[model samples]
Target: MSSKSINISEEAYERLNSWKKSNDESFTDVIIRVLPQKRNLSEILECLEPIDEETAEEMKKAIDDEDSA
Candidate 1:
């Protein structure tokens, strides 16, 4: 695999080095492996708080129009 040189602060480098699984693994690999996955809006929307009163009224009107179609 291809590789490139990178500059980092001593503290940051130490952090990544501490997380490294083995000498064969690179800091880049460690970062990618630890990265969090993105979440979909629909998955969390059900838990969403209600919109403000004025916006809620406008939202109701829009939703009603959509439903009448």
Candidate 2:
């Protein structure tokens, strides 16, 4: 496969280097591993478990107090 040259800032290079799983890992691999995957809102919502009523009320009260402040 042919590879193309791309330019990146020193800071960006350093950040990508830091994400390398090992010295043998390539920049392409690091990018693939670190990048976020696209997910639908329903998929994201499905991951969340429902909280109990008491805990829910406490959280609501905390928000109300923060809003009042």
User: Residue by residue across 4-30, what tens digits does model 1's lDDT show?
Assistant: 888999998898899999999977889
Q: What is the TM-score of each candidate against the true structure?
A: 0.45, 0.57
**Which model scores highest in lDDT?**
2
Q: After superposition, how far is residue 40 of candidate 1 from its true place, in Å?
A: 5.7
Q: How much lDDT does candidate 2 score?
A: 0.94
lDDT of 2 at 10: 100
Model 1 RMSD vs true structure: 12.6
Clashes of 1: 0
Cα displacement (angstroms), candidate 1, residue 69, comes to 54
lDDT of 1: 0.88
